[model samples]
Target chain A: MPPDAPAHLSEEQIISLVAYLAGGAGGDLAVGIGDDCAVLGGDQTGLVVTTDLLVQGSHFDLELMSPADVGHRSMAANLSDLAAMGARPAYGFLSLGMPARPTAAFVSELVGSMVAQGRAHGLKLAGGDTVKAPQVVINLCLLGAMGNLAPVLRSGGRLGDAVCVTGLLGGSGAGLAWLQAGRDPAEAAAAEAVAAHCRPTPRVAAGRALAESGRVHAMMDLSDGLAADLPRLARASGLGAAVEAEAVPISPAALAVAPALGGDALGWALGGGEDFELLFTCDPGEVPLLAQVVAEAAEGLTVTQVGRLTQGPGVTLIKQGEEEPITYKGFDHFQEPAP
Target chain B: MPPDAPAHLSEEQIISLVAYLAGGAGGDLAVGIGDDCAVLGGDQTGLVVTTDLLVQGSHFDLELMSPADVGHRSMAANLSDLAAMGARPAYGFLSLGMPARPTAAFVSELVGSMVAQGRAHGLKLAGGDTVKAPQVVINLCLLGAMGNLAPVLRSGGRLGDAVCVTGLLGGSGAGLAWLQAGRDPAEAAAAEAVAAHCRPTPRVAAGRALAESGRVHAMMDLSDGLAADLPRLARASGLGAAVEAEAVPISPAALAVAPALGGDALGWALGGGEDFELLFTCDPGEVPLLAQVVAEAAEGLTVTQVGRLTQGPGVTLIKQGEEEPITYKGFDHFQEPAP
Candidate 1:
């Protein structure tokens, strides 16, 4: 085992391997690896827990994001995992790594924002740890209660299940692109795009409705866009996925800002990350009713079908009345995962 | 507020303020701040959770600690918090910030040790997330079951309660000192000190027994030694404390190595942190029976009474028949507390 031996696996594969090696779901662990949150206590009625960490440079740009925005987004990223499982936010433990010379005001604002964000969804901050580090780091472990509803897992999808998405997509991706280019924030659509990137809402109600409807077979939050996230869902369910190019729900902000930014809306819709929307698979016969259920549950936020789960070895895109193989590059923490 | 304005608050005060502002124990939160672990669901039943984060440069010396040692200590530290509350380990979520270009072997050893350590206490790794970081950062969130036993809190001590401690003290602190002094590990008393520093056994059974005896008032693991941790316990209980210097349990290893290292075993025993023993307050009437119960429960370990909780404004150390008010300058993350 040379120290420089390059790992040949992808990030997803590496995570799966880690999960597999770490031991999968067992007694009292209803679902473990390859799920939005680990289901503990029971299958349908127990606790769901998720943990996430965000670094300063890798996760956000300080030039554009205020301390409050950083805290808010960190909370949003973790809560979305709970939303994917339709778990009610309960309590959170936040561990912070502050810079060595951190000012008291900065530390106070950063923590205050996280507490406020947790309060928005009825989650309380119970306890935490703070240590000095080179840069600001936050790790949040959230526990949610799963009362009387089966946590919709990524592995439950069946072949031919209609693939649906909540709200629009790519605004967050387009927003980051716009901001990274140092574009004017006062310009038309810039504020919307920036806000989308900084504070995307988690689709909690929509996910809960889908789970309660008993029509959805699988569900996951679209943090990594469809390109990266769809394959995960399909792979977890032991199926494949297909996306209709024209049917993809591109955000109005992305559509409006893409031309000025010299980007492609459809590409962003397909591959852009940080959308914070819900992606799901449901019985095709109940698509209309499920859409209605989601809209009614989430205050007129419509969930539209983009494609279907299929019996295949990989994901494909249907465009111009022809299906073509697609492997859209997406953000992965690892350049190449360990085998 | 100016960003650079000096904030006159200590780290502990800052933490307490945050907890107070965030919200104290309410609803299902049995105990919020000032406790080893946050008790959730009910007072005597349900769960307890604790979170801790360890950074490479600040918390550990990579030169002295292998990846496996790092993993082991990280798990041990979090589990000690559970022991203080008399909770049985259940599951854990480990979030990692892996350095870019990490060796596969290093990653394997690090993760494997953590999983193995969790299994020692019947805790399983449920799920986790990883992002690239400049240095290795490990954050573990552990949950344990209360199982119809009341969680011992730092705020439970009463006036005139006898203060007690489990096992020996100062071995870990002395071990760290010896290693930092560049002493040979093969020398006399060095191996024991190094092992004590690397993998201190948590007093899980002792804590459980003390809780079961129903005579223990307040309890906490001695992570920060008597000088630092005792004040915290006293403040939490809204009382003062007195420690008899002669009665402080000094580890044989610390005593043996102190002369050669030109250090005072008494000072190390008082100010030295990371002892991982349980410091508790109990009813004086049950001292004899409590000691027997602890000995029986924890496999012949002795629990010795050292002092008493008092009705006063501060802690005092009684040395050689002289009572002196002592702050002792224990380990505080902040240089000075903020006002």
Candidate 2:
């Protein structure tokens, strides 16, 4: 679930649920689901892994996607997590369940795109399992190497670190809005927004560059909207956050589409998740250098400071000098409308 | 898809389809989908990983299984794959899609069981993704360490190598037979078979032991039964295999229920998959020593030599001095009646 799953079974809940299982495991396991990717400790300390599932009619609408787009988006979701950890992508395993038997061509295109995505991201589509189900389900696991590199974890942020996000937000949400409204991208002004929602690019290069910069304190990808995801980063770091409402970078595409769809761009940027951009915290003085490094590493990318990790215990929003507790919750992507 | 899917889409096909993408990738990739697990190469050469998917009504029956059993069985499937490679289990990532909202107890039991199963197998349930779908879907990806352990590849067998398997076959299939026939184990004489079907064990300890013995040449688990799985091992080794029909070990439970079900125990042992037995080849002279090692390593486990790798081009079965090509196919666990 992404944001408003009702069952906000967040990483915190999952950890609490599995607390009984974590009591000393021969010292092999380190972190669980609280991080962007699981960090293997002790003997496997330098390895990080993550898995994400996409269900047809739940995470994606097959009607609006080409097989390639589905593959790309699914791959991107996992890749983004690995990126957040500053891990170098290595191997990928995919398991798929297709309820309907399309032509061999359809299967080929679908799988080919996955292979292409893996190759594009330096990930090898190494092994996978295929089964039958009631709908199209894709499960992807990526194993990455953090060897010889420092992992930027979500818990490392300092109370006074500047919270930053790379790239604009709300575009993906607006694209989804356009889609849900039955406006085809080809025939709608929200085509850019739809593309943003559909073809998310994992910030592998920028993440790696940021990690290498050694200035980043904590990092994660904004998949569940900035409003909900920022609090998670703050909580993970054992701190709170204060965001300037005006500092939230709304996407141009979202701005253009919101008026047409009668949607609020600010709300979408704050609460309409699915923007696969890197969110990090760093020393205030290093912000400019961090932005420059990411922009140079990955073309056309920008880093914006939206807030600061605060000493307080709850996230607050600064609107015209008024501080208000954040109340925006995101829908669980797993339970959400199709991307 | 498993053995008898009209569309086998075997690893060979999967590899062939991606050959274009595998041509040159900065020398990072070493292998693809043709083995029990993908062999990571280059900087991460000491690792092996595998993934498997289980779907409701396709791979398992909820009515016949407790959530714990489902979790264990799913874990066993992937563990068996890692075991085949002589890999040490490290981390596991799970992806689940639940169609209906079961009670909170159901969810806890399901996840807790997965955690328990991972703990029992020295695996850490590190991360996972959850979603809502029209039917239950489970995908597990396990990453293992081959460090300091020589991985037993399916292609390592030499001509005249003894073909062997761990434990009995056909019991799981018989168990499935009972379940599909609506015979509850509480009042059934095939209770052991039902137990076998519901709680198939992966031969991890024995597999690792075999790899340590350094005598076993090629290896794989019989997830798709002996008849179908043996040929895969043979093909991978660039050789053929010949099995003695009378030597194929049939489980006592399978034997006891075959007559009751009017089933041919031999046929089930050969083709009715889901046995989860490790099948391997070794130097004929090392059979006794290899068997003893595994027996010592994994109590109550036994390895038996059924035949030998041959120099021919295909698999053959000899019954009473007559040789015949094997034609008994297995239903893909991903396609057939639930296990």
Candidate 3:
């Protein structure tokens, strides 16, 4: 673990680091970490790729984050994008930056976590680069397959489509609020919220099911809260939407903690980021079947109809007796945080 | 661009940024950028990938660097890794951490320059993530193909082979020194040296030739200066080497600027980092064709037989009739800069 000792990097250490991180699923990876470029099994067929970067200080704080969580979240963020496009992940290319004096154990833990998550997602860590830097930065690019299926884009929604979301939201928002308030929650609540923040479960199965149904029009993962992201899908599809306030699904756990946190459960469900849930729209005729399919495919996750796409250009929230335009604002990269 | 700008970006600006960074000489990339995931036109293939992060104040100074140079260098650094492995570049995924309110023209110029340089090297900018941060940080991940060629690894060399280096060195070190001293060089010399510092040329063709020949036993790129990197390659290959100091290819421009910069030109060539030239070793029999093949393959680049891989396990420097043990010291990430 000493900074100067390279001998600590035994064969086991190397294997443990790369076993899950790089290599081909079909055993066609020519070279892995010991060499420079990984030689993959080749045939010019299909490649689906997406890249994302997560900064240490910006995305996650090292002081409060688990190395495994960092690794999991890094891969999860990119995989969520792939899921939204209904792609089956096959391989990944990662580039990492860390301080030179960092413990090999730290690096190993991160890589080990990546390997575990990558395998779970049916992806092989094919190759990546490492360098010493001021911050621990991760740039992960996933290569996946869209076999026989056309990718679903955000521009496919049409008028009369039912806007839907898979699973409950606001858990991540509650967790962030807990952390920000500098007050710790009880064991079960804290664990649930923290896990929501740390390891997001991307709705890959629901996305795939939607893509296969031939009824669902548009789909995207909710990384930036639904209130902000819905408008993006709407704009892309050239349609507006109307959502009943009561229809938005808020988790019981989120509701239980919202009052204590001095934040609204509805607000988090509407605008919480990093939930990694799927927000989609489907034809009204296929609603029942699609909902059933999403429920079954998503391991009991709820598929709730939160809104309906209309032939217009803005989102509106319809409450008990009044309707108001839903401002499309969520997490802004440069905006000051709300007090 | 303002942070609150509309989500819909101008087609011209997007085109200017993305279109120019496409096209490569090797591999079948299925989807290149315009879509969600770039589909490499291949199936179940092994892939080699790497990423690097360049931070402002840590890597370079914005006051002294041009946007184009920043774009070029950030990408060039990652390309150099692929070059060291003799991999043909297919595409790159970029991740930028920019300060909010950055000049749109600056982003455009940086992206444009990256696109232009990518084309020159037969590399395409696939897609990437962008976010706001306090300082500018560029993270680039490259995906390359090695085909069926044997990847020249750092662990394959045997003793008694001729140690070779392609192209001149130490110009970047001298340039940095001159910049630190704040002493201006003659116009041409200043331009050349600074260019060498900012825009390193990765020896891709030479790397491919070295791999294709099946003669070179070991190889690596000189990014951390020869003094530091040669030892790394030797350590990886389980061998030692002896360098004839006079045999190193010194840049005339570097030599002209060294005295004014308060450093030795030879020292820069031996210890200056970021040259991105290839250093390798081959058997005595292969030496006959090494120069010819290198010239034909690398064109304007020069390859020199600088030293010999020895039976021992350490590096030795031989100058004139005198010999001394080489320290293998250069830019140590852990150590503070020379006082």
Best by TM-score: 1
Which is the winner by DockQ between candidate 1 and candidate 3? 1
The sequence of per-residue lDDT tens digits that candidate 3 reaches over residues A75-109 is: 88778877887777776666666654555456555
DockQ for all models, in order? 0.49, 0.44, 0.12
DockQ of 1: 0.49
Worst 10 residues of 3 chain A by lDDT: A30-39
- Relative to the true structure, candidate 2 has a C-alpha RMSD (angstroms) of 3.7
DockQ, model 3, C-alpha based:
0.12
lDDT over C-alpha atoms for residue B43 of model 3: 60
Which residue segments of model 2 deviate by more than 4 Å? Answer: A1-26, A333-339, B1-26, B333-339
Ranking by lDDT: 1, 2, 3
> First chain TM-score in every candidate?
0.93, 0.92, 0.83
RMSD of each: 3.2, 3.7, 12.8
In the range A209-289, model 1's lDDT, one tens digit per residue, is: 888888889999998889889998998899998999999989998988998999988887888888889999988888899
Question: lDDT of each prediction vs. the true structure?
Answer: 0.82, 0.81, 0.69
**Residue A2 displacement (Å), model 3:** 51
lDDT for residue B241 in candidate 1, whole number 0-100: 94
* Model 1 chain B weakest 10-residue run by lDDT: B330-339
lDDT of 2: 0.81
